[model samples]
Target: MNYIWDLIIKSERAGIAKRDISFAVAEVYSPYMELSLESLNARTAERRVELNPYYRFDHIFDGMFDINNDEDVELREQLFDILIHFLADIDLTQGLNKREFYIRFALRDLENGAYGDKVMRSIGLFGREERDMIALNLLRLYETGEAVYLLKDTMRKVFKRSTIYANCEEKDELLVYVGQEETEEARAKVGLIMDIFLPVRFHVEFYWNRHFGILGLEDTMRQDGIAMY
Candidate 1:
């Protein structure tokens, strides 16, 4: 919970608007919880649900954080605090929904490390037999921006001689440009390595020295013995 508050404060210091920060938090937390603007409005307007004393926010707003309204701001803060605590207490190994479990798992991984190569490898093995594309897509979308930032940092470290620029062109596509010349094998290797770390639905495209390309994931089987992409 403190981590979430710290993130909001850090984002504010980094010049991100309050509304964007709210949306970012919503993006990560909404999927795990039954959160919707309409439901929140209705619930908060009616008799308060007594989940906890500190979590008294009626509902989360759609876009703007409404900083001008003191109650609204306070409610938003309370809602986030409530969510963080609620999510933290959920037992992932119990009878939780698979999607919720994976989303929570991925969020934990991201917070621990920005889905680095080693973390990705571990998650890949952990989820190797799982094949819920929708859940994976949600995780990928939530981490897309951070993944780009981490990818750029990784490229800077790995290819010091080359200037690397990485950007998320769409929700699911990452475009990476390497200034120096790279062989076909080198480009494929870069793409393949990143593909292994990213969500199954997300794709990475590499462009270097006028060459453009992408890597493909191998067909794999799930725990149910069904083949998956």
Candidate 2:
């Protein structure tokens, strides 16, 4: 995206602004501003890929277990540690300092050798399609109504298996049935829907390896008095 910073001139005695000089300066400094803008965008997830793809994808998976990604948390911690250590001594009295100091150590504990689950090789980059998909999905999440059927539909799009709500009868609580095969990314999306999108008055909980209600046999499979489960 070609961009330029307009030069404004306001002089009392000699108001002279040459188009040729203005064009030349604009041409020279345009690239600098472009790079500067990109550098500023480096601080954000949407444009972080331009400077570092590793960091961008790491934010998506909340630090994948891939060593290739540090699971994402390691590199950030390393840089933060160097900056914190620069303070001469990490005094745990200051709130920000204390949080950063302890959080770094706790994250390191999550490393856990990365023996079998180390993220190796490419976990893939965040391209235009992934970005667009997320945007569209977010639109669906926000636009979709908050009824039982609507919530289930949104979850179906995110997870392969159908998400059964157990506590639908209870007005104040929602119980989500869980399956073990879901990916971390999928779980993260589900968590976002439950934690961020759900109304404040409702309590959401997840239960695994159990069914909360009686199973109803499908009408299509019922024949004579016996039905397939």
Candidate 3:
């Protein structure tokens, strides 16, 4: 109706009262516009039923899981409705998330109706931190396994202690100078990360360079796990 009035402005007369004309036009146009809008919405919802998965439209997921693909027609319909409606409670939005990503992955994969049981029992599979770690591992899967790069960038990220040094000694040994503050857990993780990102030729050794011995002197005495400062 407002649009009709806007169109009428372009054809308004210089000196005439045509408010009555607008009222009559609107009386005819408003119902037609309302009906057209409703029909358009209905058409859009119908499209979503074929292209998307949500609520009643979730029948798009039929024959997806093993239960839905099996010969038991009654069981398939029951389980498909039950599972989708249950997961619908977790996310009601008609948009994609991790849940949708898995669904799409299963759809595109050739292992049709294979991972249904796993998806049902996949309580610990798609946590945010877990997915983030998976993504990071994939991104760094091709990092150069060089010693200099390890000392420059990789070790800093994997180790807690900031003050550290690297040395290429004779006999194919790489000497690492580290503080006593680093924990054994951190040390082990550093070794694992280095093993993944270091060439196999170099033997890595960690020397805790904080003085901790009976002499208690810097750069001289040696203890069980501590070396010279």
Q: Point to the candidate with the largest lDDT.
A: 1
What is the overall TM-score of model 2 with all chains considered together? 0.31
Off by over 4 Å in 2: 1-134, 141-150, 166-170, 181-186, 213-229
Off by over 4 Å in 1: 1-146, 161-171, 211-229
Could you tell me how far off, in angstroms, the CA of residue 13 lies in candidate 3 after the best superposition? 69
lDDT tens string, model 1, 1-229?
A: 1233333434434445334433223322343333323353331211112122122233533333433655666667667555544443342234667776776666466435564655443333222213233235436656675555444554554455443433445557655555557775456445533653454566666555443322342222223432122
Error of 2 at 36 (Å): 33
lDDT per prediction?
A: 0.43, 0.37, 0.39
Ranking of predictions according to TM-score: 3, 2, 1
Q: Weakest 10 consecutive residues, lDDT, candidate 3?
A: 43-52
Clashes (backbone N, CA, C under 3 Å), per candidate, total: 1, 3, 0
Per TM-score, the best of the predicted structures is 3
Q: In angstroms, give how far residue 172 of model 3 lies from its true place.
A: 4.7
**Cα RMSD for candidates in order:** 17.8, 19.8, 21.0
Candidate 3 TM-score, true structure as reference = 0.33
Write one digit per residue (lDDT tens) for candidate 2, span 1-229. 2222111111101232222121111112332242223344332222111112222223533433344763546566445334322321322223555544444443333233221123111111222233233334434545675445545654555544546553546477766655444566556556544543465676776644333443473522334433122
lDDT of 2: 0.37
